[model samples]
Target chain A: MAAAASSSDWPGRYHHIDQILDKPGPRTDPGFLAGDGVKDFLRGQAKILVIGAGGLGCEILANLALTGFKDIHVIDMDTIDISNLNRQFLFRQKDVGKPKATVAAEFIMKRVPGVTVTPYFGKIQDKDEEYYMQFNLVICGLDSVEARRWINATLVNMVDPEVPESLKPLIDGGTEGFKGQARVILPGITSCYECSLDMLNKQTQFPICTIANTPRLPEHCIEWASVLEWPRVFADKKLDNDDPDDIDWLYKTALNRAREFKIEGVTWSLTQGVVKNIIPAIASTNAIIAAACCNEAFKIATSSAAFLNNYFMLIGTDGVYSYTFEHEKRQECPVCGGEALDLAISPELTLEQLIETLTERQDIQIKKPSLSTPTKQLYLQAPPQLEQATRPNLEKKVSELVPPSGEVTVTASTLPFSLSLRIAYTS
Target chain B: MKKNEDAAAKKKPKTSAAQIRVQKDLTELDLPATMKTNFPDPADLLNFTLTITPDEGMYKGGAFTFSFAINTNYPHDPPKVKCTQTIYHPNVDLEGNVCLNILREDWKPVLNLNSVMVGLQYLFLEPNPDDPLNKEAALEMTKNRDQFLNNVKSTMRGGYFKSVQYDNVLAR
Candidate 1:
């Protein structure tokens, strides 16, 4: 607190900005990042949106405000909890159960005058496309991969190369205990979030046989409850974990199953953890990760320093190790790069099989997909009339649908980007 | 009486989305051999108790109990877990709020009660001094490892560790 007193004052506030201030005496050539007015550019009306108001979000907001940004918007659907006080520095005991976004914004506005932070106390999906377009940049401190992917897909879809202003750079940060990473995502120019599917590890899944016939771990029992018993008993009632009655039914049923198998140690809390897939988090990692993200944001906004090429990987375990490298763009990136996707399929495979295969692919996911060739509209997923017409295509062989090794366009209501598949029949 | 009965039948308790997920999750729980679960009432899925008798660690041969309360928004939100037994440990604070990540900020829709129990069990086996909810206990564990062990054993035997009284967790 004593050391921060120097920078805490208005007069000594911009002292840290000296490090990034460009040199006056230019030698030969200057780039976009070079020269004066860097300070003015940062202090300019550049609007930034920060996703998540948890550990990382709390630090990112304070960093952005201290880094000379004027207009900031934060969106989070969570309220403060008692455990958050350990790391979430901005909040107090009284603020528990309060909307994180609203409380965070009000705190910042009170602390840092001249900074107007509008907080959205809702999910990112709640807002329309137009609402996101207003921001100069979007910084995400989100914990979930699903939320990250949604935000990534939304940003990629929103990118129009023709409109320079529409190019929203999504700077993302994630922290788990001692490990964290920050990445700079240039929607159309550099690799988008969807470009690198390999970076995200496959979600752990147990075999259906293991979960059903022989359940060893608690996770297996939970999976059985989710995959089998839920549908068997509560077919009419869609399972929602938030509901106490639904949970109660599942718990009793699972307990009965566990008792029948003579398995020990099944609890209601255990069921919740298995279903939720919770991870570990700490304050130091959140602080370190958020700082990296804010640093990248400052560089990107003011061009004070060259922004992270693509990814900045960090590991705080054992010892702190960090490296920055440019992640290459995939030529056939579904979200960003629009081109024909090459697929190797068997001629004997039916449209149903191919649709199943495409849906399961790691890079691309399409639910209720439709296929069409140049000459014929092979299948359609929408409209009662069209679905009835395409019902025959499911049984039709792949070779019969189109030439053995030809191309077809795929369309789906859920997909943000359509695909043109160039198929090569193997058998 | 007839009118009241009709009103009761008409106003059925609306089931929540979280309850459905919780119901699904509860049927699949896999807990450890050392621990057992007890529900005060079979109808109440949200509140339950967990009893653990660790075979190994500083709190060895000691019994510990914890109470869990799941909110209506079970999967999306984490359940509140508290230690029923007062003990000297770095993770579990004096007020019974345990310092487990899954029980707090690390919580997600995919995590279940089983994972939380394992985590809590691990705390007894190898308490983390790095992230401490109790500063005094953390200092003892990190600064003086031997003294910390002694303090834990003494406290478990129904004595004071740092002038703060703890219940006898040892199996009598």
Candidate 2:
């Protein structure tokens, strides 16, 4: 059946489901046979929702397509640009100015004919929940922590409230610089993304850094690049009539170098024509990270996998990558609240419900001692074992203090190196 | 040289949006003459090499090689960049992956090549362990600052990271 669907002629020959087995040609590239390898790994015919078409999404789409995933939906409100060429390999110059989804779908159709690619070209809204319900697995390839936090809360309620014992939610990706990390959120079986986010947020301030950290970035030794518009730039230079072969290297060098000049601190308008140079290599990391994501997702989809839930897959440029696992130690965590089903319910809770239920109730109260994350000035000098070993204990202790589904932040250590803990009422 | 020629020959016309954007970036690029672009193929503008000899930072003594692979769609998209050279820093992965955000979500078409190059260079002087590509490195940098510094020192001298030897690295 898989072979009939994947053969080059499979599209033409197998018009009906009954004609699945009779087709021949050694299945040519035997693409469906590839899918057949892991068909049993999937929990029924699962629908997949991809959230971006940038560097990570491009690689994820290609890897998934090559892996023979048939029912896949991608959402990205972006157009193809010259800057993307550094990492996104799916489109070409001819494809510039076109919708990324449309071109991406066409590319897939040419490369792998059987799979269906639906493109949602717009900002993903709360109303998009109806479309999100169709998928069993949600792969987040976005670059924003706010978006990530929102998706975590929303998907839990929409996709599977129970946070299936067997299923794992995988967030595989890297950020602007060289930092790349992946984590697996197993709803009921392990700590969900929200629990991790709450913990990470209260303790380390990972959210604000990932969101507002841009201006803080020092320039890369390499640079971000800009797009090139031909015929115009050329004609403007009065080169349209010049012999193409006569383009002088020395003269071109001076002209090109001139393009690199910029006036710093000039009002924003003064720097208008200056182009940014983007490093293509960092763009490639998106592909590598995406491949790793698909590989892990495939493993979870096919086998009863281990070693992934609530762990960080950290990658380095020198090819150094490691998986650091952090498991929730409490049966009823103050942060995660025992991975309770109610924790995954509806992103519709209002401020009134939260304030009346949380503030007025005896069971609830915000516990804010002081944020003492590992990076905090207070926790700088403490022994690694002191903080690392005490994390679970601290989490349990704090979770017990906060109300069910309420949040808390704790800081206790000396100056330079203090440890902090943040707990959310997930139970 | 022949391989260079072949790579160059395989370069298709810069029709991909990425190539066009790169070309535009190059045309308007603002770099010291010390920086240069090597197009193994004028046709394959997306995949090219960059050479930078930093005048500042721990990487000041060294010359680094980087490979840039642009997506078919140029300006609107972020380019995939990799460090061809192995540098010991919290942000750069051992496999040559960098941790720059402008190339990721913060990316705007308005950003050009100089921004990324400067960002990559800044990594050499001060690696941000808090926002790390290698969490262990970040952890170690945060937890064991001296040792992290030592590891970086040894690696740059063309020694080993963990047990892997990176002795054949090229000089700038």
Candidate 3:
């Protein structure tokens, strides 16, 4: 394969890499460098994974493919739409109705020869740890904050203290129209996404009073339809936001409310936007952010340059501007930092009661929880055998099974990050 | 090679949230007679053209055309807009990349094509000399208001200002 790096088989596109093969990056471990030199290492074996083949994903795939990455995998659950034509630049109108990951992979494979592009047209959660562990690095072009948090925790959990070679670098990019940000996250090194969770503005939440009693804005009226009207009209049914009928019903109901209140500018788009909480995205912003993210990924992979210290914010409105600075990691971050949190709970509280109590708490919003002590499984919320074996424990006092004070690791899919709690029982 | 698929793609019947909203918005279209929108291809709802003739303002009696490209992900994402004409204006550039805040950062799902149209109309009635896309036009307006008005007149008359040639925009 090293011979292939020199022969006619070598991709002519990477002709400029000969100058940088001797240059070493900040990483010193010989194990981190593949086979022989940097060129052979980057062009021969580096495995890269891209999450979300939407706006940023398309650009990242192209950038990585042309940047000398050998093997790449893209995962996205979205389908191509007519609207993606302006900025995605990969998929043509003919590619509509196809999975984004599949189409993006196909498009890249055809355009960039010698590079293998694998596509996963499924949810990120569906992929297991073994799958992600194969990748040298992960680049996220995702739109959802929850999805990013899940990937961040998953990558952080994969970092083994004994194995320095097992470290996985995550480069994340996000955009809202003219504004965008890209950041480098070296798990247990730089600030993980959760470490900078507060940096994300708290998602806009409509007050119940404004939504119910005084519906002034179109958003307020939409909230009223979903939060109040849905329950009142269809007591037995759950409102499916994806359903056009459900949206139409909300639009009509909200518009009627708006008319009564003499509020202007109540439209179907606004109703849909309010219900789904859509963020305005721009193709240009996605392109800019993706380029920065891929630049960091390429630098991290080849050591061509130093990676971003931590974060870079790009603003494209009014000419253009960008700023880069390191965002510090929090010491108490549940995923990568500190020991189990110490919790004081009454010994008389049952396991089910504790679960209920945790659900009510904003910090630990696990509607269903499975708890285990340091040695044995104390209680599980699922599986017939485990549920039956732990059924009595749920009814019994917390002190009887978990003891007064010890560390317990809690697992739940709903949680943004995993929890390890030290139970300090009270009288 | 993908022509067959592309032709087939031109046949999808799915109506997205933006499409539904665009339909509703057009039916309720309350634009002044000076502005008009055209959909050359009924099958393709994402792209369209809007022509505006400013009845009054610095560029009054001049007709300007702008193109809008709305993504299926519309409402969540702002539409791609271009001036389509070469003009000397403080808000729109030579390449047609307009610098309207509503078309960029200030855009919301609540705002539609009508809102964008209104914004463009307002741009003519009173071109924002504060936040300008063409800085030269902005500077001219700030330093010498009469020269700026004369420059606008020249731009509409197919003349050159600051060495930037503009296409004649006045109605024949």
Candidate 4:
């Protein structure tokens, strides 16, 4: 097909996209200019990064390539699994165990002909700001909340008020079963993923006693097998969640427990789902969400149409319901909001207790947090020597450690930006 | 053989985050004079037993023992606390389940081992009848305080109350 196509055929291939760029409409972005420069910028110079290569990622990559995005880079650290073939359309049976990013990139570049897709088979964290800054925009098809928060914080922190190019617009898409959402985040301008942490459902947990002694539900029995029985039976060996043998053992154990309790409804699939915390994914849902994300990306890239205000939610489970609304930015958001977040805490709270509160807080959930003030380093979670030296600070009262100014800075392993907290001592 | 044994020993799991936090909490524990903590396995800080002997409550002269089991997600999650012995109390059921607010809905990561110890102590000091695990005890305490006290005294002294046997938790 590449040999049959001539250079003259390239312009005709993108004729539909050229029509939008060549003629401006009433609903176009305010800064959009009607000319060939928009198309030239999109096809010639624009560099976009697509994070993740599963489910929605394959669709997003295809949509971008078909919409005339030429230079694209994708990063994914996951390897191809047999289960991913149902929704991730880029790989075949022979491609199992290969990196998703590399396979997806190769597939896209081969089919699209004119587009170039570079793949990095590594974590998004491995790339520094220098790599991320080179891209004009980013599209995330990530399933992990932590990865989304990391990228959102990174883009938000990269924005320099003086440099316009440093502000990378992040378009994020997520799908769970028949429900999904796509949102446009102009870094330092719109509601980031961190600002909407409460929108996610809290993970459900079974009580220890119910699972240990009186399990009434199938899930309870499964938890008993995984949480209590697994450790006791295999004390030295860690249960590999991905290994089928381990899952089979857990399933057998849970089935026995359920039989003893006279409870029904324990199946192999349910056991795997419960153990792996699987969310049902449909290819149609991924396509719908990815198309929404790519539509926003095209608008942001070509200025052919007005981009989504902020958020678009689609619910296909209940007769194809959809809604678009602006998700407001939180002023106290730790990533992109004000100078400092006001935390009301008791004066007697210890530094360790404060770190724990930060870690468990719903809105600002940070893992492995380290704290410091202007005058001294209160505590550090890393570099064994420093952690050992600052270990005693964890026991001291917050009032004793904090200065009169009531300002403390916190850094976490999961976050790309430092959080400034202003302590408001509660009586 | 010595090198291989050393390697195997090193391969043993390092202290988890939950264990580290529990150790920190145990180290800084400021238990009152009436309370005592005993770790059956000193190396395993994740599981321990706490004995509370209130000095000046209605339940004075009674020693209540509770087993604390901290899981791997600690601080993020509250410890599993259960009464070691079933007794006649409003918040403690016959199956040894405790219904402390901090252990359930009101559990925040800011709460420490010390806070839980204090909360458990407060439970003995003031057994809240409003929220009860044992409804009969709650009803008895609410309807007739004198009879409730008698039932508690009898139950604490290793007697039968309402056809259920009770262990003698009285201080020796």
Candidate 5:
């Protein structure tokens, strides 16, 4: 442990962290005990699980390591791309095409000695509850909404009132084009990611007729080329948005279509951006958001100071504005509320229509959902034979399939936990 | 369990919200005698056809057939309407795509199949020269009305215009 090492060994190495952990001031947490043992615990015991190795992940990993967190694990399913070199400072030209988690782990551990970062080059879903239960806390820098929801549900489900250690603190950070947010979610104690699901912006979809016929904008032309022309031209193959050749073909096709319509502004970068749905990322935003997340993690782990209430949002586009507020836990939150969400529908609505409503609802977006009542299964999207058998039930009226209690359980491929819904038939 | 599943699969299919709404729309339809509808498959009300024969217009004697496919997202999303036969009109393209505002941008959940039928019929009665799927036809209509009417008559007779052959939609 670093406690046994004499302070003379490393003159200024532990000086900064020592000053904070060695003494308590006016704003220190009431539970804080100033001593060398706090530093030792941070250096030897605290285990962290970081959920991405992209822009914010790289910055968070570096900040966590420098903040005296010794044991760290990171999970990233993406490989390093040349485009990521602009903001993900941990990766270089030589590191392109390598697993992001592995390269990031190697870079951080090499830069800072005595810090061990274990990299998982796979999806976070691949790891089970037991794997997550071993960690002291988890920090997320993931950009995918589905992944964030899955992890949030998993962590919330792992909590047991009887066991204290099962309650893992989750620090999440995200950044996009000079705007970012950092929040702390204490599994069962505070508001979770699911509680604020409506905060996310809905995906923009161009109308099919607009893209197919009257395209007034460059994005509309790009959508036409990618959505309509690509499928018609390449019947057997799918467009790989990452490949330069595919993007070039789309750009040329869009450019030609734009010229036919006498429209302008069809560029290669715009084609790539439209196809990949790339958000503009800035390095400074990532660093700031990551540092905020790490600061929350540090305070939560050591209790040297009061942690952030729940959410902190920063908008740097107009002269650096920021705000911190407490996001209340929703009573109808499917994950932490422990109450079935109430949904009112017409009694004449068929099972298929009900399923469509569930899938389309922004707050309860579950892809390929299987539903079941207490006594009978309404529909199942899996296992060929079962799916075929339940397929007929899709056409049946929900009033006929569900019991008088109107309680149903929905499970989906995108979620880690089943959703409980209380259906009310509106006459 | 396997036998039970097979038996369940063989049972009668139930109606969906889209089917219910479509049935309601058909029952309440107030179409003129010049317009008619047909169901290719009686069991499937979601997919049907509408034929409109304008009474007094440039396309008076011509019968235009449009196929409508309504999915489960009906009312929220408009039905997929397409001309069954390619015709030369300002609003209808060479590929039979229609350019009706109600069918695309102005669609609302309150709008029903009857509304769409009326919109389609109105296109034949008065083809708007502003929003055109066929720019050449729209331009002809705007620049020289007589020449546009000639092109429409010739195209309806299964003749060629600008090296493009159109389907014979004229009534027998």
Candidate 6:
């Protein structure tokens, strides 16, 4: 494998580093660094999209040029921080704060002139139809589960609609400390991401301890099943009416906790700090995941390779690497089963289906009548306080109105009142 | 309406953390004379224009323009790029989509603007259609080599391109 990469020769051209090194007069030519075969491979001009420009993306991208993948597109919505320098080898101390996609593209172009790089320097959600169709393959290096699921659903669904027979493969890879897992979705030939999610959901049903071998929370403790009642509590006392007692309790229990929860979950926790916590080891694990994803992608693009239609996992924690072949034609699986051929998911129908299921659920019903509406919404024009009470209810209410989840927040002050009247209709 | 208003109300600071980094990248950029960079809007450092005049190969004498849009997320992400100019190339789509790896899927934080510019230049010198932005272009180049060459020549010569009017400048 190492033999494939030829030694880099200084082609005697002015490089990016040369500018920084230039003392005064003439610019120093650092010479070119493309392997002899690099030019040949890049000559074909394959357009590839790397979803995340994180640590894994950096290593994989560097290797891509050496391997001859020239026309590359990168999509990442993140900034180089002081912390990322450890293993995100593509960046330097000077690159801190620059856009990763722009900087990465620039870095590759300076070293190798025989390649074209474009950067979709925004969140993947910002990508439109033109953005999605431009690239041939999408190499997912994103760390967020939401991002991974979005990519899988969007790209795979888009490909299926436009070219069902040639549904594009989505290679989602990630690392958790010492462990990395990559799943390849060949669309028709194998289980798609949704199918994989179903499998995970099934695993959860078999008792968490059985699957993960970790102890579950004690049954006695309240695990925040619902905050729905809190909205009514706040409304019943009218905290906004400046009742000192009502305000104190609200702040002590609900308001303070909610505020803290938002900050903890969104600002600090949402960041891919899990990967950052382990430093080079986690980053290296991420890089391995990326390589595996790309390897699987290459096979899908060119022709069938050994690891086609399989889920490969590398556990650095246990120093083990193994793959589990997912049955391509599983009658038991709902996503890729025989029935799915006719009931294939479409992007247009996906949102509608999701909304239908969300609203149809018996759990989420807003109270009717003007008196029952949350006083804040009635006065300040906000979502009812009840809407913010529980996670599932909140998600359902918001997702019913809007298509996407994980971004929007619903609080108790946003929920509606008149529960008795609303319950009468349901009962 | 509230969401839209909230989004609109949020003032994007004149010098965002990402923009500051881009400025640094630009100052340190060792751009060749053949390649020049321009900011369409001085206020928006995130989005800029790149003009490339190839000194050699099939795209010689032809000028190409590309648009670069940098998200607020800097150095840790790749910038969005599109071909602003319509050109006859297998890797570039009629809609101004480019077949660049770093921009798409192979980008790393370690790579910078300098690397991307060089890659764009490479596309001009040697257009790769294998992972083509335009599948038709790739198919023609791979399966019908002669027709592909003719199409490229005609487009370069400022002739009618598939019934669509295009301004063509001769190659050096």
TM-score of chain A of each: 0.73, 0.53, 0.77, 0.80, 0.79, 0.53
DockQ of each: 0.01, 0.02, 0.01, 0.06, 0.08, 0.01
Question: What order do you get sorting by DockQ, best first?
Answer: 5, 4, 2, 1, 3, 6
Ranking by lDDT: 5, 4, 3, 1, 6, 2
Which of the predicted structures, 2 or 5, would earn the higher DockQ when compared with the native? 5
Positional deviation of B155 in candidate 2, in angstroms? 58
DockQ of 3: 0.01
TM-score for candidate 1, residues paired by index: 0.55
| DockQ-superior candidate, 1 or 6 | 1
Quote the RMSD, in angstroms, for model 4: 11.4
Worst 10 residues of 5 chain A by lDDT: A1-10
Evaluated with TM-score, which candidate comes out highest? 4
Where in model 6 is the C-alpha error above 4 Å? A1-42, A160-166, A198-281, A304-307, A327-427, B1-172
lDDT of 3 by residue, A240-344 (tens): 876879999999999999899888887888887778777777877888899899888877887656678989998888789989999988764555654445688
Predicted candidate 2 versus true structure: per-residue lDDT over A1-427, tens digit per residue = 4454444444343233213222323422333332334452231265677777878888888877666466677877778977667677888988887877777777776777677778877766533444555665667687655566555544443333333422436454654445566666654446655454323311111221232222221121001111122221342443321233323322343243333543123222111222212233376566657876776665455442333555655456567666667756333222233221122222333322322333343433322112221111111112222223233433233333333333222222111111112223333
Candidate 5, residue A125: Cα displacement in angstroms equals 2.0
Candidate 4 local lDDT, A329-403, one digit each (tens): 976455676444668789999999998898898877778776666445678664344467679989999989874
Ranking by TM-score: 4, 5, 3, 1, 2, 6
Worst lDDT run of 10 residues, candidate 1 chain A, spans A24-33
Off by over 4 Å in 4: A1-11, A235-237, A340-376, A379-427, B1-172
TM-score of each: 0.55, 0.41, 0.58, 0.66, 0.64, 0.40
Deviation from native of the Cα of residue A219 in model 2, angstroms: 6.8
Query: What is the lDDT of every predicted structure here?
Result: 0.73, 0.50, 0.74, 0.80, 0.81, 0.53
Residue-level lDDT for B155 in candidate 6: 77
Off by over 4 Å in 1: A1-9, A22-29, A32-36, A244-268, A339-427, B1-172
Put down candidate 6 lDDT per residue, A1-427, tens digits, no spaces. 2233223334443243233222322322224223332233333534678888887788767766554566788888988866778888878999998888888888887877565678868898776544666666777777665576556645543443435533656677767668777887765567665445423311011221111112132210001111122333443432232234433443344323444344223122211221122323476787677777776665444332345457776767665666666635443222233221111223333332433543354664322211111111111111122222212332223223222211111112113211111100010
Assess the local accuracy of residue B78 in candidate 6 as a C-alpha lDDT between 0 and 100.
71
Candidate 4, residues B1-172: lDDT per residue as tens digits?
5344333422322222344345445545667888888767543557888899989877999999999999755665689898988799988878677867778656765578899999999999999887776778988999999999999888999878889999999998
Quote model 5's TM-score.
Answer: 0.64
- lDDT (Cα, tens digit) per residue for candidate 5, span A256-347: 99999988999999999999988889999999999999999999888899999999999999999999999999764556764346677888
